[model samples]
Target: MRIVVLAGGIGGARFLRGLKRAVPDADITVIGNTGDDIHLFGLKVCPDLDTVMYTLGGGIDEEQGWGRADETFHLKEELAAYGVGPDWFGLGDRDFATHIVRTQMLGAGFPLSAVTEALCDRWQPGVRLIPMTDDRVETHVAVTLPDSGSAAGSGERKAVHFQEYWVRLRASVPAEAVVPVGAEQAKPAPGVLEAIAEADVILFPPSNPVVSVGTILAVPGVREAIADAGVPVIGLSPIVGDAPVRGMADKVLAAVGVESTAQAVAEHYGSGLLDGWLVDTVDAGCVERVEAAGIRCRAVPLMMTDTDAAARMAREALTLAEEVRAV
Candidate 1:
């Protein structure tokens, strides 16, 4: 089977791991979100891409669910001592090498897609991982920030990189707006459109829908390619029973003006791009609403508590795809 999956960071990575195990012989292509990519210390960092790479390659830190296993932070510590840092965003020594190599290759004029391929040669992530776009497309959030010296006054609204709002502020502030800067012009990375065109099944794992899958769709032609592909394009809802299974998806969802509910998220994707949608059993009430919106819908276990559980979810997605194709 040929599978194409749109993935974000941790949740996406974990789901890909299970998908690999579920269909061991299937050819999988992951279109990773690059909107979260940020430059730090003059090095480009692709967080979502690295997470998927490490998780699939068995080098991911199991506890943190991101970064490398057996990672050390000597580099981060040294940078902090020099007072040169975005200390809130932890880039350990092991992870730093990845950014260093990527930045070096980027400086040599290699597009991000090519650089990603070279990096994956070492990890052997078991899937063809292509970024959503080789061009720079950053997710920025608008929020209210209190002035540094003002003691008592309404804060001013300001725009910040998605990482700062996520890693530094922890999404505590309301995201008044979420913008995918440059997505309108970003071309799909090499093999992205081809993979979608050839896929037997396409999946939207329970990654943050707004910043992850949504960001990828923001790239020009990507959404149109999948919608017109004439294959089963299914999604597992990240919003399980009215809340995200992981991460602060609700905050971002709100920014997009979508309610934090399985039905609402399915509707957000809509029948245009999605053929089938899966909601957790706890959200069984939403199945009819989603189906009524002209997309096939099912209620299933949606948690990726472990590889086994995630595999089951993968199987369910495949089953749903088959059901959609049969129609």
Candidate 2:
């Protein structure tokens, strides 16, 4: 099978590990979310791409599900001591090397797609990983700054980088708006359209919809390519029981005016783009609601407790894709 997956960070990376184990012989291509890409310490950091690469390359921190395993933070500490701030975002010493290399390659006039391919050369992440766009697209969140003892206290609203809202503020405040800056002008990466055109099955993993998968779709021509591909596009619910399985997906989902429910998410993607949707067993009652919207809905276990569990989810997703195809 020619499988194409739109992937975000931790959840997407972990699910890819499962997808690989589920269909070892399948040709897989990952279109990683670059909306999370940011420049820090004068080095370009592609968080989502690096997460998928590191996880699949067997160098991911298993416990955290991101960053390098056996990672140390001497470099971070040194930077902190020197008053180089933004200490909230932790970049380990080992992980710093990746940003340095990526920034160097990017400075050398290599497009992000080429830079990503070059980085994956060392990791050999199995699947062909490509950025959603070669051009810069950063996810920014509009949030209210914390109240200080002043008249303008809570009235202050500012747009911060997605990482700051996610890592620093920890999604404590509500997100008023989520914007994919530059996405409107960004063109799909070189292979993105071709991969979608050639895909037998396309998947939306249990990544954050608004910022991760949604951001990828924001790139010009990418969503249209998938919708017009004439193949099964299956998605597994990130919301198990009206709440996200991990992370603060609800916060961003609210920003987009989509309810954080399995059925709601399926509806958010809509029947046009998604042919099939999978919900956890606990959400079986909503299957009819999703199916009513013209999407083929199925209830199954959706948790990825381990690689084996993720493999089962992948198989179920593939099975659903087949069912959609049969229809």
Candidate 3:
């Protein structure tokens, strides 16, 4: 199968590992979310891209679900010693080398998609990982600051880098608005729309629907291409048992007025964008409601607790797609 998946950071990367194991012969393409991309210490960091690369490249710390295994903090500690800190997110020495190369290439006038290709040449992430767009789009969260700076949503909106809101504040405060800066003008990166057009199947992994997959669709021609593609487009639920299986998804889900529930999440994407929907067994009761909305719905174990579990989920998705095509 020529499979294309829209993905976020950790969750997306991990799911891809299982996907690879499930369909070793399939040509997999990942359209990764770059909204979390940020400039830190004068280097451009592509968290989702690196996460997917490391995980598939077999260099990832299986337990941490991110960064390299046997990673050291020497570079971080040295930066902290010099009073250069935002020490909240750990950018290891080895991981730092990736950003350094990417930053240099970008500085030399290469767009992010090209720089990412250059980086991928080394890791060979197995699946072809294309960024949502070549444009510089950054996801920003609007948060209120306290008078004493304790924590309060300012009546006036202030935008902070997504990493500051996620890794630093840890999504403690409500996000009034989430914006993908520059998305309005961004064209889909070279191969993005083409991959969608040619793919036999398209998937929305257990990624943050509002940010990760949503940001990718926000780019011009991306959603339209998928909609126009004559193939199965399926989505796996990120919300399980009325809560996110992982991450602060509820906070961001609410920013888009989506209730944190399996049914609501499927409804949020709507029948227009998805051909099939997979919700956890715990949410099977909502299957009828989802099918009523014009999507082929199935209740299954959607959690990716391990590689085997994720592979099972991938098999279920394939089965659903085949069933839909047969009908």
Q: Which candidate achieves the best lDDT against the true structure?
A: 2
Ranked by lDDT, the better of candidates 2 and 3 is 2
Measured by TM-score, how close is model 3 to the native structure?
Answer: 0.96
Better candidate by TM-score, 2 or 3:
2
Q: Please give, for residues 236-281, the per-residue lDDT of candidate 3 as tens digits.
A: 9999999999998888888889999988988988888999999999
RMSD of each: 1.1, 1.0, 1.6
lDDT of 1 by residue, 1-327 (tens): 999999999999999999998999999999999999999999999999999999999999999899989999999999999999789998989999999999999999999999999999999999999999999999999999987788755788999999999999999889999999999988999899999999998999999999999999999999999999999999999988799998999999999899999999999999999999999999999888899999899999998999999999999999999999999
**Every candidate's lDDT:** 0.95, 0.96, 0.89
Candidate 2 lDDT over residue span 278-315, tens digit each: 99999999999999999999999999999999999999
- Candidate 3 ranges beyond 4 A from true positions: 149-156
Candidate 3 Cα RMSD (Å): 1.6
lDDT of 1: 0.95
**Cα TM-score per model:** 0.98, 0.99, 0.96
For lDDT, candidate 1 versus 2, the one ahead is: 2
